[model samples]
Target: MHLIKSNWKIALGVIPALLIYCIFSIIPIFISFYYSFMSWNGFSAMQYVGLANFKAILNDSVFWLSVRNNLIVVAASVFGQIPIALVLALLLNQKIKGAKFFRTIAFLPVVISTVVISLTWRLIFNVEQGLLNNLLDNLGLSALAQNWLGNPDYAMYAIAVVIIWQFVGLYFIIFLSALQTVPRDILEAADLDGATEWQKTRYVTLPSIWGVIIIAVILCISGSLKTFDLIYVMTGGGPANSTEVMATYMYTETFQGLRYGYGSAISVLIFVFSIVMIILANVLLKKRGNRKPV
Candidate 1:
């Protein structure tokens, strides 16, 4: 009777979630792969078309541009946001005056909706009367002022800046929490041993927070890959798909163009890319963990 009850409880907890996962994720993925081999309008019959979609994607100039733009975002997120956030985290962990207030203010942006951020930044970046340009003009730096969003060259960078601004705080918080767990004695010992600030950070602080760094890297990768709202609301992949990332491209392909089959193919592509990134991240993380002192 006890065994039967335990089995029933397990089934009850697991079955519903499994069923939901199948319906939402697993089944939809298989369907996308199936459809990628075909072409179909939403209301019409799908025509089987072999590797044509994949081949076409290989030659699609816009797709390549989108890929390049995404890579740029990924690079900027890693280089611009992560390291800076870690530095901020270290500062906040020092029991400085107003530390909690600064932490709260930093993280407030993350809680705000992306659409709102996009809209706000759009206005801020407005060419003529926008706050950013106006401030530059006021400071006698009008030569630096330009139409940030309208210019194809600067649009992608502008969006990336906004994304970094919003999300950096969360990583800062993660690093701060991880920093608190480092033993105080270790730091004090390093101070006593006449270790320089740079040396102590290099050996003690970094090694202690390595795991949190791994987690932050993974999060930044995923978040960058899936970036859509800022690109969408701010640029709409625009001026010419210059700032297009996979999420926005997939969305435009699927809904804006009403090419369900092509959209599904892009969806599958995104899934494959995300999986590869996750695997690569895990491999690097494991290597780091192995090298760190236990």
Candidate 2:
């Protein structure tokens, strides 16, 4: 009774947010799941398709190719972005000169519009007059320059690079915050025990922020799965759809191809995949955390 009386205002505050979440997030997901079983262009009468879309998607080569591309993006994000972010976070967490300035510079890319970043990189990846090719020529390595975004073999990699560059800053900020929260006494004790900086980092710093790392891992996985805008603006899943990921492919199917039902199916799959990955990550992390000696 006392708790309710004291925290009633706080509980009231969440109602508005809960209402907004249900209206915008929860309702839309249910609608999409419902629509996944129906065939309906925006202007046409709906027809019940009843798993036909899922069956078709199973047989579709392009769909699987897009899934493969999404997996690549996920791998790049989990492996490439997380490690780079950790390094940047660790470096910036030091008591160095101009730390704030460097942190700001590192985080600047995350706040920029996706379209802007895509267009900026688009010029950089251009074959003939692009920054990359020009730099190669200036370095006398002209033979090394190739069409980064045009060739099917290289297009997905180019997109993955852009994706990693744009989002690493966000993860860096998360890691930096976690790093700052590590208790100073523990670090001092490690130093007194004659631990090197690398040893302290691996043993003390990382273990202290393991939960944050797991959360960041889950965020990276989910974000990589939903990648769309930059790839859309840069490649439009083009050069023969080599750069296709789930969200862009979903957009193409629904808005461009007008296969609303099939697109809904794809969206559902994306949601399912994201949930599964997050759950697996959480379970694995929790298990590992439990096994670790206090």
Candidate 3:
């Protein structure tokens, strides 16, 4: 009590930011929760529809497709981005020429505007005269080139590839920083014990950065669930809605379709799904972490 009283000025300093967060972030969440139970077209008086919106979502094939596509994004991010980033981080962590330059180049995409990245990639993915197709043609791989973003069969996968490419540097920087924090003395001890690089990495380095890896996985899942801007720009959830995810679906249904309540319900489900997936990931990773090494 005395300690807190002594720090009262600090508490006073934090109160305004906390208030702002509650107003903009926390309060809106509860508002969405309330709106999820009521039917509203944004202009009309909200009608209390109970669970009808959720019921509709369950039977809505489009919503389910969005969920599936969202999961694919999550899977691609978690599996593709993290591993690639870790590998790159590991490689770059070593003493190499122009390492800083390389890191800067790798991380450039993360700092660029999402809309710009999407627009650039859209040009590259263009059916008529895209850079990718042109390159494939030059390599005598014209058969490999198809309508990259125009075809539904390949659109989502193509977006997934872009997602992986854009974010790998973010995690790469994260892992690189985490790698720097691993104790040099511990690594030296392993070296003295004649441990192979693979053995040392597996037993020492990875275990030390395991917490960061778990956090990265959770971030990837949450971010993937809320993916909108890139796909919205690149494909606009199109090529017959092949690239639609929960966030895009929510935006279209709410603002475009004007089914505010249904959109709220979708938003609520997105929140629930994010929480559930993060919890499940933590549990699974914890179990794996706890298993005795054979």
Candidate 4:
């Protein structure tokens, strides 16, 4: 009773936020789980369909295609974007003139709204009057000038490039902050030991910032998995759904196809995939951390 009384103010302070979270986040997730087991058209009535929605999703080809595209995005984000961000961060972390200006320019894309970025890239990628094709034509590289966002073979890659370009700044800032946290003493020690620049980075800088790298990887995975807005604005999963991802696929199923139950199942799968990937990443990183150095 004494403990409860002492914490009453804290409880009261938390109630509003707790209530909002339950109402906006928890309840919708529960509702989606319930709806996943039923056939609903968003109109007349929901019919209890048992595992029918799951069955349908299992056999969905386009759904699998979307999953493949999502995996591609995840790969590009973690492998392509994060490494480049790390390099930029390392360079910018040095005691160089105009470092702050370079950092600001690098992070500028992260502050821009995704919708605006998508629209800007869309114009740049336009085949005829756009900047890229015009540059190619002027350089006598007309053969390389093709419809970047329209060709099925290249559309997904094009979108992936835009995604990487737009968000590398975010991870760069994150890595830069991490790099700044590294102990200057350790770097000095490494220099005294005659460690080459590469040796210093590989042994001191990277290992010191491993935790931040892991967090960046997790962010890349989660963000890539749930990516929707940019793809929607840019491609709408177009050119025969070549650029489709899980979020866009779910939206298409629910709103466009009116397959509410199926879409709910897709949502549930997205939640599960995200959870599994996060867990696996944590486990792998933990194991790596626990390993004794040679």
Highest TM-score among the candidates is held by which one? 3
Tell me how many clashing residue pairs each candidate has. 0, 0, 0, 0
Off by over 4 Å in 2: 290-294
lDDT per prediction?
0.87, 0.93, 0.95, 0.92
Ranked by TM-score, top first:
3, 2, 4, 1
| Residue 183 Cα positional deviation in candidate 4, in Å, after optimal superposition | 1.4
Q: Give the TM-score of candidate 4.
A: 0.93
lDDT of 2: 0.93
lDDT of 3 by residue, 1-294 (tens): 989886997889999999999999899889999999999998979899999999999999999999999999999999999999999999999999999999999899999999999999999999888999999999999999989999999999999999999999999999999999999999999999999999889989988898999999999999999999999999999878888999999999999999999999999999999999999999998788766655
> Which of 1 and 2 is ahead in TM-score?
2
The 10-residue segment of model 2 with minimum total lDDT is 285-294
Instruction: List residue ranges in candidate 4 displaced over 4 A.
Output: 1-15, 291-294
RMSD each, Å? 2.8, 1.6, 1.4, 2.2
List TM-score per model, in order: 0.90, 0.96, 0.97, 0.93
Which ten-residue region of model 1 has the weakest summed lDDT?
285-294
Please estimate how well model 1 matches the true structure, expressed as its whole-model Cα lDDT. Answer: 0.87
- Looking at model 1, residue 33 earns an lDDT score of 94
Q: Against the correct fold, how does model 3 do in TM-score?
A: 0.97
